[model samples]
Target: MAVVFENDLDRDGRKRATASLMSQFQHAAGLCTIIGSFTFLFALVIGLIR
Candidate 1:
């Protein structure tokens, strides 16, 4: 979905599209970091209980 939307830019539109894609990428990266941190924390707690 993101890739499809990103590929439709005209010359002027290309700059906007690039910025939008960067914003999207940053958002996805942040979410992954948060999810990963919590996952590791939970796994550590589970291991300690065993």
Candidate 2:
């Protein structure tokens, strides 16, 4: 989704907008990865405890 939006901005010749969108998308992806890892670890710990 973010990639598609970024591509559209790039096609429109909005360099700054494309860069901003790419940065935001990267940040969001990083956050999601961190959260997902933590959640998986927490679930694993709970399962092990049981």
Candidate 3:
């Protein structure tokens, strides 16, 4: 339910919403880090080849 919306009027709902947002942020950060590392490695290889 928190994936799209957190439709609760209680404090737990707000807490869950924050948790979901943080999880999403963490996931995106991990993905970005992986891609950045791969790209860096690729550039390093190309530099060595040239």
Instruction: Give each model a TM-score.
Output: 0.70, 0.70, 0.70
- State the lDDT at 17 in candidate 3: 62
* Model 1 Cα shift for residue 32 (angstroms): 0.1
Candidate 2 lDDT (Cα, whole model)?
0.76
Q: After superposition, how far is residue 40 of candidate 1 from its true place, in Å?
A: 0.2
- Which ten-residue region of model 1 has the weakest summed lDDT? 1-10
Candidate 1: where are CA atoms >4 Å away? 1-15
lDDT of 1 by residue, 18-45 (tens): 6767878887888899999999999999
Off by over 4 Å in 3: 1-15
**Total clashing pairs in model 1:** 0
Model 2 scores a TM of 0.70
Residue-level lDDT of model 3, residues 1-22, one tens digit each, is: 1244445445553446666677
Candidate 2 stretches greater than 4 Å from native:
1-15
